[model samples]
Target: MSDIYLFYKPFHVLSQFTDERTDEESPRTTLAEYLKVPNIYPAGRLDYDSEGLLLLTDDGELQARITHPEYKLPKTYWVQVEGDITDEALTQLSTGVELKDGRTRPAKARRMDPPKVAERSTPVKPRKGKGTSWLELTIMEGRNRQVRRMTAHVGFPTLRLIRYAIGSWTLEGLKPGRWRQTTVHMPEQTQKVTLKPRKKGRGEHAGSKTTHKAHPKTAQPKSAHRTPRKPKGGR
Candidate 1:
């Protein structure tokens, strides 16, 4: 089976194996320090500011399967926005958004009323006379800060972003800086085939002759504490 890891990366930690700017006064934490296994790389990158389930694997084929755009794995996010989300904004997000880069794919977005989300340690700045709202969005693409950009485009700037799930894997029970290993059933092309046992060679018999012999007996050594010929000699 291929080796795959699910890491719950904390906010402000770089996703790279090593920090390029290690000379700085405060170097960023990286995945290499947390994961000791060798030859594994991240399937895709999560922005340093975002926190959630991040995938790593030693199998390049599995990595390609997950990160390649053609596979189209869905990523679910729990987002907090600056203002109350309108039905129009939800519709726009579901339909599509025309960003400067290009039009994004249609997404699944909905307002989460009475959101059952964890409170952030660092609260976002509250605008005057404006209330915040929560939303759950699932998208197929992994663009840079796409969730935040999309929300901002819809006139509701995202204040906090947390990814909850990726494909069938979720970040349940994983705390910040903690990780877990999970197995994914890859496509047939990626699975390894077991070879059948070869037939016995010529002159090899099913039942081979065997012999057994009784073991030879040996004299036991006397203990050092035993007196030798005590009766024959006087002290």
Candidate 2:
């Protein structure tokens, strides 16, 4: 069976295994720091600043199903905004918000009571007068910083975003930088096979039967942790 892992990614943590930047001295943390399990990789990306549930697997098909836009798996986030979110903003989010890239799909958005979340290491900047609010937002599509952009488009800039769930997976029982494994039965794909002639023994006939077998695809998840990297300047 292919390896499947569920990880709770913390803030400032990268979803990948290595930092792509060239500056060696610049401290950038990656999944490799926490995960010693080799060959597993993140199925999709989570931004350095965002924290929440991340799925890793060695199964390429499962990865494609989770990350590919065509599958449209629902991803839910617990978002904290700069101001009290309004009904109008909720409506816009539920109806679809116009972003620079394009209009986002209508999402599930509602004001939420303060969730029992662990305190962030780097606390969100305390707004002097403007109060902060929380919202539970679910979207079917994965766009680069889409949640942040959507919230900003509707006037409430997102200060903190935590992915609460993805499809059937959640961060339940998993802590930041920790992971667990499970076996899954993924739909098998049709495969084509080519035959190769079998080697003949000394007594075997000149003509020998050939055989071949289709290889099954499997997947696994790599190491992960919550380590937020500062987003460059402008939000």
User: Once model 2 is optimally superposed onto the true structure by TM-score, how far is the C-alpha of residue 30 displaced, in angstroms?
Assistant: 0.5
The C-alpha TM-scores of every prediction are 0.74, 0.78
**Model 1 alpha-carbon miss at residue 117, Å:** 5.5
**Model 1 whole-model lDDT (C-alpha atoms):** 0.67
Top lDDT model:
2
Q: Candidate 2 deviates by what RMSD? A: 13.9
* Alpha-carbon local distance difference test for all models: 0.67, 0.72
lDDT of 2 by residue, 193-231 (tens): 222223222232223222222223222232243222322
Model 2 lDDT-worst window of ten:
226-235
Question: How many steric clashes between backbone atoms does each model show?
Answer: 0, 16
Candidate 1 structure quality by residue, lDDT tens digits, 1-235: 3556767777777777776674888877777667776677777888877777787777665566667787677899888898889999999999989988888899999878644545455667768988888899999997778898999999999887888887756666566666665443323332222212122212222122212111111112213342211111100
